[model samples]
Target: MKIQHFTNQLHLLKEDESTTRKGAFIVLSAICLVGCLTFVSLAVDIGYINLVKTRMQNAVDAAALAAAQEITNAVNTAPVGTADVTQYSRDQARIAAKDVASLNDVFIDKQIDVIFGRRSFNESTQEFDVTWNASPSNVVKVIARRDNNDTSAQDGKLKLFFAGVTGDRYSTIVAQAVAYVESRDIVVVHDFSRSMNFDSYFNNESSARLSDSQIEQNLELVWNDLQMPNTGSLAFTPQYLTTTKSDYGVSATVTFKYDDLEVTSAGEIEKVQVKYTDNSYQTFNGLSGNSVNINGSKNIETAWVTARGPSENEPVTVTNNGISVTYAANRKSATMSSPQRIRELYVGFTDNSTDYRSYGSNGPYNASYSSWKEMDYMYLEVLDGRSYWYYFNAPNGGNEVTLQFDDSNWEVKQAFGLTGSYPYPRGSWDGFINHARNYSEFSSRGFRETYGGLTLMNYILRDYPGHWETPDLWKTRHFPFHAIKEGHLLLCDFLEDLGFDDHLGMVSYDTSHRQEKTMYDSDPNVPSVNISSEPITDNYQAIRDLMQYKQAAHYSYATNMGGGLEDGIQMILDNSRAGARRTILLMTDGNTNTMDSGASSSLPHGWDWDELFDYDGDGNSDYYTNSSQRRYVLRTAYDAVQNGITVHTMSVGIDADRNLMRAIAHLAGGHFIDVPGGASVADMESEVEQAFHRIASFVPPAKLMNQD
Candidate 1:
């Protein structure tokens, strides 16, 4: 009976232990399952938040960039310093930010804020700062925010899918971006002229051929010639004499020694002799001592003087010892030391400048025997049966010398005349006018065309950033390459570098004699070689070649500033080039000597030059009558401003019309770049380089100054 009772007790104890173990196992499994669920929820929520964060950040970045772009557009299209422009810029920025945000598929957002201001980086503190000034803000900042539990439509709140079971129902995300204006488009107008051939400023004779006396004056030589007191008569001893034949005629170079001794008493000059290398000689007689005239007077104590006869019947004289040596009227003579110098380099225009008259005679203030004679007078003679003007330089002494003709050392280059084709006589005012006329003729090709104008343009454009092996641009927004045609890749890259949209054209104008011949109205010969109104094109070389087509030799060399402005506007307004920032570069080196109003009677964009000038409406232009074409240019520029086109003007050499360029720039809201090519070759080249670089420089890509 006892053993059976003990077995039942053991079985009951085993049952109790089994029950405890099952309960503990169940509890542990429940805890593990809850922990796994919590972890899974956290992972899912965190991943969703990260995706939202990325989308928000991208949207904000796009919005900021858009705002910055809007600012650039405002700068390009709006009139500078106008309140309307600032306001429009702000509005555009806001609109752009919204549009970009939506396009980026950032619909579910709590709020987006776009702010415009000035942002700068502080190097000292290594931090960026923002200043609020919307009028002309350079920076655009955007912020996007989202928070959980808001549950509002498009609130950007993340709704948790699994975290809800863990009592976590919401999450928040926010993104911020800052962008600044980057890149700008600019156009440059350059002027080319004949004077540009000169190495230095106008009338710089430092580098020209000069005589010993001239060299002394320029400090290029020492004045070591023999000097004699005024106590005796002037005397000359010929040393070397030679003649050379040229296309013009025979020319002579004579070297002689001279003494400026005073003539105290009257003495007869027995004879005057001129000897040549060929054993030929000439003698003058019947000249009495009392008949001697010193300069313009026959007064006593007049040792030596150079004097010209009052008329053809008289003669120029140099007196010594009561004896006068005379050169017949129209004959020019000089006295000097050994080695005669070449005076004038090449004869140029000197009206209202020097005493050079049309008949090749010296006027007032030109001493007959001084250096002026060498500079102003050309010896006229017949040699080898041909007529020529002998280039002469005055000697450095007062001794009298007769003309000994030689033609051995004659040089056509030393003989004054045009250098190349388009021959115009030199040494006279008429020749200058003739040469100028030839330059104006369209068919005339000269150094100014091939080497001056075209060469400068080629150099500036060839080394331009566009032709670089790699496109120079910042990495941002990828430049929306899809907006450009495939054929325009290079052009787009260039325009991008220039801060332009690849909408560029050329408008060339030379004054035309025809009343109706004007820009656009007249046919631009070989239109295929001309640049047409178009969008960006990859063929930059082709455009450069087209620019070269307007060679300096082209017909119509007159500067018709109004006509150029006319065509320039038309090009900017062309239908194919619409939606681009319009700009024109009006460059010139001369006054507006030719112009035509055309039949339009109105300026571009419905403006009227007549309205600005013809206040009386008398059917004639009136305002700025002194500068009719100039007035018309300003009027056209006003129209350009109204039509949102910028016109930048460049003045080259001293002769360029600066007032006109300034007026155009002011009226069209563009900058004036005075390259001042007249300064020097180095200065002109440096200015050109700097000007192009300054115009091409653009604001860098907007930076994320501050982010959250």
Candidate 2:
């Protein structure tokens, strides 16, 4: 019985052991499966988090950049000190950010916060700070952080898919930018003509009638406001004064005098005065006398002595005590005597009033009174309405005007002329008028007017910013390459503003004149050749030399054979290497006929006969002859263009050869412009500006690099 019980127990134990092993294996397998699932979950979750972070960062960056760009644009467009500019900037930033987000197909989960502040560097803190929360936040806290900062690593942030996995987690982004005031130095040149200075009829009687005091006052005002550098202070320098007169027969003279007088006794005194009987009187003072005489008799009296005269055909004579003294008139000469020693004498006779008139070498006669009046205390009159007269005391012996005889009881009064017409020469004034007319004609025909009213200095000033820094301020008798280099990039001035036209006129007028000449030369009947052609050879090359020289020539000419060609090519290459893409602006009148190299052509053979006849030949010519020289120019230009340069051509004038200009422009990958050639320089400058702006707009901003 005992043996049978033990065997049953062993069997049971074996079964129990097997059951335990199986249970353990099942538990282990369950643990492994669970661990694998957890690992997979973590990987998926992290990947989603990363994707959200990237999208948020990208959105923030785009928004920041857009906002910055908006600020820049608004600042550029708004006038200084305008209150609305800040608002406009904010609005632009909001719109730009919104647009950027929309383009990226992302939605901003939170409001964007934008803040603007002035950039400040704190020495004590050793940190740079920009004001934040200064502007209204539209999406998030737009913390403007420096690019160097760690916290601002991400420009902006958007909460996207990561919230589900990271428990509503958010990211921070900061934008960094630089802002500073930009300034450009400018030079301004203006014409300083009498007409520009004051409103006055051209040599009208009214203009001539202005008094010396009035003229002096007007001139002083103009001088004070002259806008010269270092003026208005006590240390200011006076400008050199020059005068030109209208009359050819009348001599021009200017005199400066200083007066020093003292009052001895306030009383009426008889004075002996000297007189020059021919020339106009200049001045007198109480210093020198031959003798004291009265009416050619020997006498001494307490008289006020006066001296005067550029006498009328007689010598200057002094009489005292029955004795007479005479002196010949000399240029820049004078005499003097004491005021109490001689009688006052007026060399030229005055009618009833103090006004003196020219008697035309006849006799003492009356003449028409001028509108100008002389002060009673003044010892001067306007003779012939042009010349001046003066009175002075002979006793002082110096050139001086004295106020010794003041009729103390006489009140200051103005003198006027009667309305009745006076005898006057009909055509005597015509000569003066004709001279004025001729002056206007010559001035108009000169380069000052012909080049669309552009002065050489004006062109330099307008075109170049660095021109002002040149040692000579770009002022040279001859065209200088230094000036051209200084101003070449200043083509901005030619752009158009709201009210200004383009600068096309400047190029047009010059080109048109050249075209006409070329056309005339091609004609067979016209003078075949001329000596003027000698200077015309290699003109274009000369121009290139002038543009590239260290000490450049003023006149533009063609380049010379070796160095000139090398220099021009190098210039273009250097500019390109430096990332300054060049755009050539060729202005022509469309007639491009030029001489063939080594061809047996006459002096003017390069000109177009057909065009010349068109200009003045009354439809006698059948076919139009083209310009070979112009074609050469075009080919040369095209070669440059094909080698990575762009060329734009403008044809001005009615006779512009559109076909040729269009072909050149097309080959060079540029547009052709046609406009009136006679436009003003200001207009031409505007046109050039416009073309540049147009070209610039099409170019990608990434290609632009600042050179200055």
TM-score, every prediction: 0.38, 0.34
Q: Residues 529-641, candidate 1, lDDT per residue (tens digit)?
A: 32332322323554444443232313333566676677667655543232234566677655776668462323346544454445356865443334667667777788778
- Give the alpha carbon lDDT tens digit for every residue of 1-708 in model 2: 889999999999999999999999999999997777666655665675566556654665665556555554553456768676556666666666666655655444223444444323333764433444443211122323212334333333434343444353434433322222111111111111111111111123213334333433333332333222211121112111111111101111111001111222111112333222232222333443322223322111112333232223332433321222232332112232321222232332222345333333332211212223221211323223333333421221222222222211011000011122211212112222123223332233232111111121222222221211222322222111222222323333212111011111111111111111111223243332221322212122222222222122111222111122122233344322222244445543224433334532232434443442243357543323245554454445445555665656554333456666565566566667664322322343355444434432222111111213
**Regions of model 2 farther than 4 Å from truth:** 1-34, 53-98, 102-569, 575-699, 702-708
Please give the TM-score that candidate 1 achieves against the real structure. Answer: 0.38
> The CA-based lDDT of model 2 is what?
0.32
Q: What C-alpha RMSD separates each model from the true structure? A: 21.9, 21.9
> Best-fitting candidate, measured by lDDT?
1
For residue 397, what is the lDDT in candidate 1?
27
Q: Lowest summed-lDDT stretch of 10 residues in model 1?
A: 475-484
